[model samples]
Target: MNIDLRVIGEAFHQFLINIGLTSGQASLIDWIFGALILLVIFIVLAILLIWFERKLAGRVQDRLGPNRVGPFGLIQPIADTLKLFTKEDITPAGADRITFNLAPTLAVFSIVMAFAVIPFADKVIGTDINVGVVYLMAFASVSSMSLLMAGWASNNKYALLGGFRVVAQLMSYEIPMAFAMLLPVLLAGTMRMNGLVEAQGQFFGLGWNIWIMPAAFIIYLTTALAEGERAPFDLLEAESEIVAGYNIEYSGLKFAWFYLAFFMNTWVLSAVATTLFLGGWQGPFVSQVPALGVVYFLGKTIIMFVIFAWIRATFPRLRIDQMMSFCWKVLVPMVLVLFLLTAIILKLGLPTIAVWLLILLSNVAVFVIALWLLGKGLEKSKWASKRLFTPEIPRL
Candidate 1:
């Protein structure tokens, strides 16, 4: 049988016509394909992050991490997934069974939903919503609600305390986080992730947003870590104090969901950090190539992930009081000052000298103020302890 190329091409065209797909509809098909690709990327990234975290933690603690599972432990996450799936699910006696079952899923769901608004690259965004940043913040708050549900449903006092601590900590940091985020939005003039990335690209020849607005960058990094509930700010799950915190009672697949959510949350935060401060997806000599922006985006996200891991490995967890005080007393003030300085710079159209001078002054002032506050807090703590320990005459 002779194969006619023109006949085959005509048959394919007829098939497209049969399915109500014009060339324009083909574009929609391409978009859907792009989205599926992004979903795959997300899954791969999540698994990679888990493996990276384990290896990093192992190295830090002087142990081999997951070396037995697959070559170089590359398949450890897959093994862990199979194990969690086959394990028996347990609901504690006297637990609110419905919410108990739903809580972990909700936590995972909220994080995945937040990813919808994030732009992975110029053309690879899932949904380019105008209120993308706000959407992210909203879903992040939902994580707190999930923790609350998990805690309350378990009927455990420790879980409740952990839930309360998480909610309180998230609330305290959210204000400063929002304010710090505003500086970037002010500079970028839009809340969309693509717009933010584009704004960064516009200034690519100058520098990354981190260097242009160092104070805001610092505030953003600190607030992001706090919001992410990473180490130092991760009192929500302080195992030594609260015995696994809000997820103490969860097990099997449910527990796995919570764990997956934590990984996903960190991944999204890294992506957001990459988008906002780094020249997201805008690399030197890369954007010139068509469709290579995703490479740059992934690179930035991975770098941010490494930074997150480094901080987690390096810093000791902050106490609850210290966490709250640091966010409100230190970060909020610094963010507020940064916002003001950014506003003035924008309005006055100042030269580089003026901008650098303002940044220097702001940093110096913040350092001095933080030092003074720490000194006062220490003195108060000592005096209060002294009075509490003082021998009292029998006033009774």
Candidate 2:
């Protein structure tokens, strides 16, 4: 039995060699295959996200979401796709035809480009580019420009307002978001997503980055939701006020493209969170099995999506002023402080327990400061509103 097992192992080794693959070469081939698989997975996930959002929104409002299409509305996305394809394409009479036509395409393109930089798992990355993190941030920003173009070219007031809101909200959130992202980069000591995953893999026991850096994780989650324009930060598409927002003038497949881009954007944001704070695809004993890393990565992404959904269900949208204040005054400063604390801990060569304690203390300090500031702001706002609105009367 031992001799037969040895022979089988030898044959497998020879087979690998015959394919022009050293162990490293075989691994590269596997990575390429995994990327292609992920591409398909992303496409399917986009469709499912549409169904999920609809079902979730329905539940929030106490209604059934698309039950007649298929089993539990499983085929609703298919029906929607077909309807979009067959609908009449309408371009407004005075709209800038070229820019209007190009906007949706740009939106979809930018999102897919951003996905190329995300490392799904340790060995399942698309490319190990030196500037992967920067590349992701850049491409993500391009989607905002697409929104700008779509709104501007449509020549609609509501679209213009929606685009402007997107610019302001996204720009404000990016500062804190970048700082939050920096936490993972500092911990991993690399910009490459694959490198980040590898660093997390070196943890001894229960050593995921999430536990090591809960503040960063919390900040990352909040920023990601804002970046994706999900609830509590979805003021850009305030339905009652904006009348369908930037895509108001869009119809047919053009409208579909906008919705598709939104779904893709959300998925990519969740994937980024999974790759950064959740250790990408690192799981105990899973690396021993070939290709299981990719499995873990997808599972992690799904969990992130569920969290996103949960937040959408629970939170109401913030007012515009409140949203701006929250991002600029609250999240950005907190993330900067966290970054400083993390740097100091790393510099001092502190033990893991010490590092965690420092992080906890920092969080406590931030919480106290924030509460104090909020109370002050509320009192001042009440006084200012009364003064401003209660002007001096001629008779009284």
On lDDT, the leading prediction is: 2
Candidate 1: segments with Cα more than 4 A from true spot = 1-18, 21-36, 203-205, 351-396
Q: With candidate 2 superimposed using the best TM-score fit, by how many Å does residue 26's alpha carbon deviate from the native?
A: 14
User: Clashing residue pairs, candidate 1?
Assistant: none
Query: What are the root-mean-square deviations of the candidates from the true structure over C-alphas?
Result: 7.4, 6.3
- Residue 245, model 2, lDDT: 79
Q: Which candidate is the best by TM-score?
A: 1
How well does candidate 2 score on lDDT at residue 137?
86
- Tens digit per residue, CA lDDT, model 1, 15-118: 76678888777656655665666667668878888998989888987888879988989999999989999999889998999999889979988987887777
lDDT against the true structure, each candidate: 0.79, 0.80
lDDT of 1 at 19: 84
Per-residue lDDT tens digits for candidate 2, residues 1-396, read 112222443565567778777987765665565556666766788888879878887887789988998899989999988999999999998799999999999988888777777776554455679887888889878888988999899999999999889888888988888888888898778998888777777555345677777777787888888888889889888998898778989999999898888878888888888888777878866556535666788888878887887788789888888788888877887888888877887788788667667766775676577668877877777434644765667985
Model 1: per-residue Cα lDDT at residue 337: 72
